[model samples]
Every structure is written in C-alpha cells, then in structure tokens.
Target chain A: MNETSAALEVRNIHKRFGGLEVLRGIDLRAGSGDVITLIGSSGSGKSTLLRCINLLEPPNEGEIIFDGESLALRRARDGTLVAADQQQITRLRAGVGFVFQNFNLWPHMTILENVIEAPRQVLGYSRDRAIADAESLLEKVGLADKRDGYPAFLSGGQQQRAAIARTLAMHPRVILFDEPTSALDPELVTEVLAVIRDLAEEGRTMLIVTHEMRFARDVSTQVVFLHEGRIEEQGPPSKVFESPESPRCREFLASHL
Target chain B: MRWSVILENLPQLLHGAWLTLELVLVSGVLGLAIAVPMAIVRCSRFASVRAFPWVYIYFFRGTPLLVQIFLVYYGLGQSPWVRDSLLWPVLSQAYWCAIIAFTFNTSAYTAEILRGAIQAVPEGEVEAARALGMGRVVTWRRIVLPRAFRIALPAYSNEVILMLKGSALASTITLLDLTGMARTIIARTYTPLEIFLAAGVLYVLITFLILGGFRLVERRLNRHLRPRTGH
Candidate 1:
C-alpha cells in the first residue's frame, strides 16, 4: 500500500522502556474503511503500537503520518521525540480516537455526558450540537436509552458500547481499539463485539488489537501478527489466518484458534 | 444561677454567634480560594513547583491552631517592621488576624484533602480525557477537578466542621465570637455552666447546617449514580 494515500501510516516505529524495547521498527498502513487487526501473544506490543500512533506513548523513534500530514516531531532535551507543537498534537488526537481495554468512561458523568464531553470541550461544538451528535452516536451503539445513566450503573458490555460512542462523538478519522472486549464477561463479549461488527460494516477506518480470532477473521480486511515487539507477518485476513508465512504467526494462530 | 440572666444576655450571644458565622463564612470562602490553587500546585508534576505548597501546608498543619492565631495576632504585632508595614492596619485588628490565621490553617488541610482526591482520580479516566484531546486546563476544569472535588467532599465537610469549632480560637485573639461572648457573660454573671451550654448548642447547630449543606451537594453530584425511575 502507498503510505501517502493511506488514512494513517506508521513507519519504522520503535519504543523502549529503559532496557526493554516494546515496539521494534513497526510499519503499518490503513486507508479509509480499512479494518486492520493486530493479534499477538501477551507483551507483543500491539497496544503500544496503537498508542504510539497518537503519541500517547510517543514512540522512541519513528514517523506517524495521519491522513496526508506527517506528525511534526522534535527531539526533546531528554532525547525523546515529542510533538513540536502541543496544539498540533491536540489537533491530531482529535482526529485519531482511542478506545481502551478498560471501558474508561468517566464514572461521574452520565453516558450522554461522557459522549458529548470531548465534542463540547475539545472540539468546541455548541451544547445543542454536541448533545444532538452524542444522541445519534449513542443510538448507533445501542445505548440511546442508557444516555442518562452513569457508567457505574451500566453492565460491562454496555459501558464498553458507551465508550465506543464516546470515541465516535469526536468524529475521528481513525479509531484504535485496544483489546476492547478482553475485559468483558464471556456472555457480555458478544454484545460488545456486535456493536463493533456494526461499526466495521459501516466501513469505519479502524485499527483493533484483539485476541478474538474468529471476530478478527470476520471483520478485518487486513491482519498483522506481532511477536516480541516485531510484526512477524501481515496480509489479508485469509492469507494471514489460513497460510501464515512465519512459524511464530502459525504457532500463535494455532494456540489462539 | 438565675434563668433570667440567659434572657438578658440572649442578644449578646446572638450577636457573637453572628460574628462567629461571619468568621467561618469569610474564612471558608477565602480558605477555599487559597486551597484550590495551592492544591493544584501540590499536584504539579514538577517537584520544585510543588515544594512551595509543601512547605506552606507543612508549616500550618504542623502547628497548633491556637498558636497560629496567637502568632498572627500577637507575634506579628510585636515586630516594629510589621507595625510600620502597609499591612499593619489589617494585622493590628484581632478580627482580621483571626480570619488570616483560620484561613491559612483550614487552607492547609483543605489543600491536602484536595490533593489526595485529585490523585485518587483513576488513571484510566485521566487517560480518556487526554485521549479525547483535551488541553490540560480544560481537562482539569471539566474532568479532573469536578470529579476530584466530589471525591474530596466528605473529607472537606470534616474540615469545615473543624474550622467551625476552630473559630473558637478567634476569641483567644480577642475577637468577640460565640466563645468570647460566653466568656464575657460568664465573667459578668459568673454562670459558666449555663453560658458554656448555650455556646455549645450554637456550635452544634451550625455544624449540623454545614453537614446538611454538603449532603445536598454530594447528592446533586452523584445523581447519575442513582437508579432511574423509569425504563
């Protein structure tokens, strides 16, 4: 895939925690309507790579180009790559929404408040416009009726769904999911996955790090298999799942499948 | 031990109670103003910036409230520089001195309470705020502080009650608050038991009012936590 034309592209991203390198020279590209899944064993840096895209973890060395503009970076006095301008970072983050493994809904706020907070505060939308948009997004995630309810009052699946609606309220160009369903109960996982499936069907640009092999196979157009901080193999879902080139990817799929 | 002495001194006691209320109201407002900013400083990521509040909180929290009042009223009064300084007019009066002391003392405790509450805010929630692209000021104002203040409410109520009782120290600085009026009534009528009882009752009544006020705030903030009446 041509990097320039993709909605989001990562080139040779590297991240290190003291002596431990978490993401090693990772490269990824996603165009609009692309559903790319990152699957790997524990500590494979799938979540780290997703976080780096928004500079949440600020990759030690690499380039992230969102849409057509490359994220401007300057080496800090401490030798870390930080956004050259904070306003630029905030603007970039507004376009790249992140959904955490733990629902992370602000418990003090109602589901509707959680959804509308970013749009009103960060995006500076009027209250009426934000609430109007929030209701529609909540409707999309099947949580319109739960709008007035606090996150603590909701079930795990419902909270996750509300979280997705919150991310969508930002009108982001790319959505990153970090093990979205990993924290749910067995019976609840399907409910959240169904919402995600609906999002994929709607053709949202998404990057998902999930362990659910079947769901990944069904929803993702592209699949990347990571092993020990490096992408071992990547291709179309059928190619990566049915005929993984790397033995590591085959072993991971064998166990997970 | 005449019951009629209580009736005769009722107006005096009420006047003193009003001063006591004023002291608490003014100090509470001023203390909160000082504490909120200081608490934010206490929670600063940099150690150097945080150290200023650290020393302020430590100095006030370490000393006795009575001593703080004494120092502000008497100790500061003793200095020639303090006497000649532009602040002398305010510092010379027992009422202003008492307010200053109480404000500083309660502000220290309030700042500590707020710092703990701000720190207690969940990391995930903070991450969600940043992930949503909120600037630091907006995040603190809209997300961090609202939740932190809610978490700090119970502890803050305790501080308010303590300050209400602590205002009795104002009498030591010669500000005719409730306790001062009671002491004066006892001096004139020599009925310590009756006068002290009346003062205790007033303090108890004010404490209950503050408790009830905080309960209302907590209820409003936590309304979403309550179950909805309808499906």
Candidate 2:
C-alpha cells in the first residue's frame, strides 16, 4: 500500500481533451500484489486516469514510472508532455495489461489467436511457446473450450474473461481494468467479476475502474474516490467506504453504495 | 452472322483472349501489391506523408485511362530525357506501356478503396492493438489491413471488374487483347456482329469468374462472422 514496493506509479497526471480537462493532477500507485479500485460516477475521470497509466490516452502532464524505470518523456509544442520514445512506451505497455469496458477482442481472430498474438508478435516468442502460454492462460480463465470461437459468438461476460486471458497471456506485471463488467448484462456481470475476483485473490497487482460498489468494497485493498477530475480521497477500502473525510467522497460513495 | 466465319477465326480469337487474360491478371496482382502499401501511406497521420500519395492517386483517378496509356506510351517515349534514360527499353514496348498505365491506374483506385476501408476499422479494435504493445507496422499488418480487406472486398471486387473492362483499352494502345483481336478478325472476315458478340460473351465469362473468386475469398475471410453450425 506504500511507495516502497510500488510496481507502477503515476504522479500528477493532467489530461485535456481540447478545452475540457479530464484528469487534473492525479497521483496513483500500485504496489506488488495490491488490488486498488477506483470508484467514481460517470465523467469523474476514473476511466481517463486508468487509460493514462499506459499512455493510451496520454496525460498532458505526468511522470509515469513502471517497474522502477521512469518513462522517457518530452514536452510537446503545446506544452503537453508526451512519450519521448515510442518504442519505450510500447515496451512499457507490454508490461502493463489493459482490459476495456467493451472487451474489444479482434473479431477476425479466434480467441486463441487473439490471446497468442501479443506474446508472439510483441515479445517475439516462438509460436509453440506463445500457444502454450495462451492455452494455459485460457484454461485459468475458464475459456479453454472457447479458444477457437470468435468474439461475436461469445456473450459479453465470456468475451471479457477471454479478454482477461488475452491480457494475462503476456505475463504483464500489472493489469488495468476499465469497467470490465460495465458493458455486460446485469445477469452476466457476476461471471466476469468472479473471474476478476479470482485474479485478485491470486495476489495479482491490479487497478480497477468500476461502477460495482459491492464488488469494489469486497475485492479492493485500497479505494480511490475521484470527483470531477481530481482525487477526492484514497485510502484503505474500509476507511474510505466507512469514514471518508472528503464530503464529496462520502456523498458520491453513499449515492453509489 | 455466318457461323462459318466465326468458326474459322476461333483459333485466332482464343489467342487474343489469352493476351487479354494475361494483361488483366498480372496487372490485377501487381496493382494490388502496390496499392496495399500506397493505401497505408495515403492514410498516414502526417499531412506531409499524405500529400504526395494524394497527388499520385488524384492524377491517376482524375484522367482517362486512354490518356494515361498515351502519357506512358507516346508521351514518355517522345520526351528526349525519357528516351535517353534507363527506362526507355520498357517504355518503347507497347505491352509494357499498357501494363504500366493499367497498373498505375488501378493502384490509385485500389489504394483509395483500401484507405476508406482502413479508416472504417473500429477505433476500439485498433486501440486494443495499441494497448497490447504491438508496434505500428505489426498492428497494421496483423490487425488493420486484414480487417480492412474484409470491409474492402465488395468495393474492391467492383474495382477488379472495372479493371477488366478498362483493360479493353489495351487494344486501343496496339496490344491484341480480346477486343483488339475481335476487331482484327472482323476486319478480315467482315463479321462484326459475331465477333463482337463472342468477345462480349468472353468478357461476361471473365466477370462471372471474378465474382466467383471473390465469393470464395469472402467465405474464407468471413468464416469467423458466420454463426456456429453447432461447434
């Protein structure tokens, strides 16, 4: 829960989409084996901060340090910070897995192909090695039978689990979940969350942005409450959920919880 | 409409059909080979990278195929610098000139078709590729281009059919393609109706075959989209 064992640390992230400032000076950290859940209402910048960790939506200002290495950064013409080395950013991204709200599985590829593609192409693993890694990961996520199926054929929950397996195939140091169950039908949400719960129980490092209050409270070691593009409060899940100091945090959590 | 005249010239007509098929097939492959890369360049992020290809595609798609043939054939051959250059050997031959014109023309149309298809790829799917750490080239080859090809297939088949017909212009440039061979036989035997009809029949046949080939490709590329026939 502290900085000493931090696997991923993002300091003072600021992101602007045109005139709209989405994330303003947010600092987040994930230590080894920690499950940090980000809870906020829609438009509170939870998703944007999750995306900024991998620089998928590059923060205009921030220092991202992954695996104890600081990301090489440079100032853009508009005074926004950008990754100085594209290769480095890509390399770092491989170390951080991301699961989206929409699954976003490659429709043209089978689940097995989708999972194996990154390890093979990005990490330059041999075909047999990648397939072995993918098969085992798929088995872990209970998607072993669905390996040959396409994304469209599977239900939303199944696809999200497969997406998780796809992320795990690379053995990434930390995984980011951006509302993994938000797109699922209410009945289907439990299966995907159960899969995520299993990952959390296994002591995997994760940062989750979610709307599911009970799941967050149950699974998270730490909870961060974001309000209008800034961190209203963050601490142990019990403290933030029960005795939040920030009135905004208490108001938002009470509304959702 | 003497059947005798048609029968007598059938052998010569077949030879001309063979030439037409060669022209269409080779250029179809060559043009697409050039087009895939050109389309990727056409859709680049940098305006500077986008501009030159824009002009290349514009000029080809803008002018008539006949004019393009002439530009490569007579226009280039006539230029003193071109005549004196290393390309003169290929430029001097009508066969190569026709191929050049058709290749360039089709490459432009194909590139434009693929550009639209590439852009039409779902933004989230591409974003997923980025988040996976696949580099630009790897993402394009493994994710973008294959998906684009699936979307581009129908429009691209239309381009191929148009190319088949436009290839009749090859005869106008002094190559003995299907139309050209038909004209030569008609001149000899004075049988325009039979000769023209035969050539038209052949063109329709090729069109049917092209459509069939595309259908097979579509089935293979889109097998994932089809519902499971019970596992």
lDDT of each: 0.92, 0.91
What lDDT tens digits, residue by residue, belong to model 2 across residues B1-231? 587887888888888888888888888899999999999999988999999889999999999999999899889887899999998888899999999999999999999999999999999999999999998889999999999999999999999999999999988888999999999888888889988988888889889988999999999998888566766
For model 2, the superposed segments whose C-alpha errors exceed 4 Å read: B227-231
**Per-candidate fnat, comma-separated:** 0.74, 0.81
User: What's model 1's interface RMSD, roughly to a tenth of an angstrom?
Assistant: 1.4
Q: Count backbone clashes in candidate 1.
A: 0
Among all windows of 10 consecutive residues in model 1 chain A, the one with the lowest summed lDDT is A1-10
**What CAPRI class is candidate 1?**
medium
Which run of 10 residues does model 2 chain B get worst, by summed lDDT?
B222-231
Candidate 2 lDDT tens digits, A1-257: 46568999999999999999999899888899989999988999999999888878778998999988899999877777778999889888899999999999999999999999999999999999999998998898888999999888899999999999999988889999999999999999998999999999999999999999899999999999998899999998889999999998888887887
TM per candidate comes to: 0.96, 0.96
Output the lDDT of residue A72, model 2.
95
